[model samples]
Target: MVRADARENRARILEVARQALAEDGGTSMNQIAQRAGVGPGTLYRNYPTREALVLAVYQLDLDRLIDAVPAYLESHPPVEALRGWTTELVDAMRRKHGLGDALSPGLHQSITERSYGPVIGAITRLLDAGKAAGAIRPDADPRDFLQLTGALWRAAALPEDRSQPMLDLILDGLTAGTGRRTP
Candidate 1:
């Protein structure tokens, strides 16, 4: 069984690593250990390698996002909830991309492979809620939404952050009554 202190240490390390990496992806393991208030031995014990730690940090972020769906749905209307959630997802994707050359190709592949299914499931939940609320089109597919939004995060490096406005348009298209009409 993982002891309470061991779990706390691991959580603290993850939190510190997440912040440190976001601020600067080049942050070192020793630096993360120091910042986390844990010894290098403790840090290594929890995450045997820098790559493992980074992967853990990323997975934790993704899990946090997935876990947030219920709260977002409870707090906002369907469309608004989807908007807020997708906005955050875009930001997360931007940050993941921001890791850029720091992440090895294998790491990139690993992250993408691990993230896709859960992300789609989360989108499915959000879409289901919107459908249940009668706000989104019955024909809307989560995969299509995911494919479209893929471009939003890819555009993050642009001088102008035009994602939100573009997202607004996408949401409008997804709105129940807005499907194309007969000519």
Candidate 2:
């Protein structure tokens, strides 16, 4: 178990790192330590490398997103749950876009894998539930769904005013064939 002071310092460091990365486009151990009101040595003691710090911050956010899945599933219909989760995912990607601006190209891949794996799994489970409930089209593929959602997120990340509309269109497509057609 970590000591109280250690845990406090770790939380401080993470918060500082997150803020620094979000606002400044990059963060260093010294910057994080200074922002956290700790010395550089203390920062190194908690996170030995920049990569380690970045991964921890990324995973922290990803875990929060994954934890929300159960609550969303419980409170919303399968299709709405999926739609809500997709919106959350776009928000996450926007956060990642901020982080990616701070991280090296190589580190970005690692962060993406660590963050997106569980997210994709949760989405797959949600899609499967929707499918079983006859809310999602029978021909839907979870991987394809994820890919399309990723594309939508990428489009949303663009500096345009149409992202939400585009997202709505995509969500409509996902549920298109699952319901009765009207004249």
In terms of TM-score, how similar is model 2 to the real structure? Answer: 0.85
TM-score for each prediction?
0.91, 0.85
Pairs in steric clash, model 2: none
**How far out, in Å, is residue 6 in model 1?**
1.4
lDDT for each residue of candidate 2 in 1-183, tens digit (9 for 90 to 100): 889998999988887787788776666678789889999899888789888887787777788888888888899999889888878877777667777656778888888776667877898788888888888876667677777766766777678845577767876777888655559
Q: Where does candidate 1 clash, by residue pair?
A: none
**Clashes (candidate 1):** 0
Alpha-carbon local distance difference test for all models: 0.88, 0.78
List candidate 2 stretches off by more than 4 Å. Answer: 179-183
lDDT of 1 at 11: 93
Candidate 2, residue 46: how far the Cα is off, in Å: 1.4
Model 1 regions more than 4 Å off:
176-183
